[model samples]
Target: MSDCDDRALIEAAQKDPLAFGALYERYVDRIYNYIFHRVGNVYDAEDLTSRTFFRALSHLADYQDQGYPFSAWLYRIAHNLVANWHRDRSRRPVIALDEIVARSLSEQHPEVVTEARATMRLLREIIRTLDPVRQELLVLKFAEGLSNAEIGKILGRSEGAIKSLYHRTLLQLREEMEKRERGER
Candidate 1:
């Protein structure tokens, strides 16, 4: 959606529930995927996505345009909520095993599926160790498929900074994987 359309929806968001509904429909899937990638759990991601929208609607009066896109504001809200979740949690890694898919895939190609799942788990564990900014960057860039400029706006950074961070993050992940492969971790 264009900035013009977002502005209209945002203005009506405070007064018209239907307008807010439109905004929710536009962003819910992206927001949910973002949360899902960060939290790595379907249920928590669902709950957090619900909370993010609920909080947005609850605080509609507080949102000002400030020349930023409506999505930037939503992303800030989501980022803050996810940060708070990380802070408040007791710190356990919870993995969502898609059992139905895994089961069927295993039946078809047991070894390949098992190796892929193991690699996925390893990668997730490595990602979970990174700082929150890098983690959010990855989620926003890949999961949301946001452009660097867009991510910069949501992250309050310059596009160059986002690019630099992205480069470093990739290198860090690659190094970690290499170490693991060499049995050095």
Candidate 2:
């Protein structure tokens, strides 16, 4: 949608709370998918998505058009919530590998799930080590499953620049993971 289109929608929504439904409908799925990828769980993703929209709806009148897409505003909200979620999650005590294996021994089919979860957790750790821009690009591209053009638009970068950054980010992540595997931090 064009900036004009979003401006109209925003104005309408500002006038009537019911009109906000249109904006919500337009962006909910994308927001949900973005949150899901960040949190890696349906329950928290759904909750955080709801919170993101709730904050957006309440602050509708305060929103100013800074020449950015409406979706960008929603994404900022989602990103903040996700960051908070990660911060909160980090404070919880972590289970040791032995404890996890002991617990998994009781499950009938834990092998695949355990392995997949381990891989994703390791990948998340590696991603967290990246610079903020690269992390955002990875999440927008892989987590939200957006195209390079879409990511470029959201990030305010040229498509060619996004492609170059993505390539470099992937190379760095591969090198980091390999080093990690070789008992190097």
Candidate 3:
């Protein structure tokens, strides 16, 4: 559904709780994927996804249309919950590159599959070493496929800031990957 459709659903849901089910159906998978990528475990992702929707449903009355998609609000809620989850556990974020790699790999060649998995594992490790903001940027950009503007809204930054951060993040990832290659040698 388009953002306009989501806005209308939000307005309707604000009036009747049953209407919120449609909104939840529309976004549940995307929100789950976002949370899953951030937390890297199915159980925590499922728990957090439930909490995110529950919070959104409870706060639906206060939702305002600020020209951003309803998903942005949902994402903001998910982001906060994930942050708190990490803070409480004192654990670093772990992007599940295995799923991502598996999806992208062709099963035609055993050697290629092994190489791709190894590369993805290395990338995942490097991503975990990045600070939270950069890791969030990567997840929002690649994992969620959100545009810079949407990410900016979720992160509370300008679009230009998101662009700059994305650029620097790519550079940093490249440098880290290079360092890993050198160390392996």
Candidate 4:
């Protein structure tokens, strides 16, 4: 949807809770996928996704455009909730292998699937080792397919900063993967 369409939806939703359902329908999958990646499980993802929408609905009246997409506001809520979830658990993040495998199963042969799964597992492990901000950056940039500008809005960084961080992140991932390969040898 265009920014204008989203803005209209937000305005309508703010005036009527029922209108918020349209906004929810537009964003639920994206938000759920994002939460699912962060929490690594369906149950927690579902819980957090619900919490995100509820919070958004409750605060809809307070929302101001600020020129960013509505998704940015929703993402900020998800990010804060995920942060608290990790802090409360005192554990490193995990990406569920089954979820990854399931998503890829339809398109690849078994052998290719195995290789892809292994690669994704390694990447996820490396990603978990990153600071939360960097991890969030990767998820937003790659997993969610957000543009650098969109990621910057959600991450509270400049678009240039997001570009630079993405470059550095790829370098770090490459270095980490090399270290892992050398150790395996």
TM-score of each: 0.90, 0.70, 0.92, 0.92
Which parts of model 1 have CA positions greater than 4 angstroms off?
A: 92-108
Please give, for residues 1-185, the per-residue lDDT of candidate 2 as tens digits: 57787899999999998899989988999898777756656788789999999999999999998866788889888888877887888732121233444465556467766775676566677876777678879879875787888787777898999999999999999998899878798
lDDT, each prediction: 0.85, 0.80, 0.89, 0.89
For model 3, residues 1-185, the per-residue Cα lDDT tens digits are 78878878888999899999999899999999889988998899999999999999999999888877788899989999999999999988666668657777866587988888998889889888888899889988987898999899888899999999999999999999999989952
Error of 4 at 34 (Å): 0.9
Error of 1 at 78 (Å): 1.1
Please report how far candidate 1 places residue 47 from its true position, in Å. Answer: 1.6
Error of 3 at 109 (Å): 2.2
Per-residue lDDT tens digits of candidate 4, residues 140-170? Answer: 8767999999999999999999999999999
Candidate with the larger lDDT of 1 and 4: 4
Worst 10 residues of 2 by lDDT: 91-100
User: Residue 52 of candidate 1: its Cα lDDT?
Assistant: 97
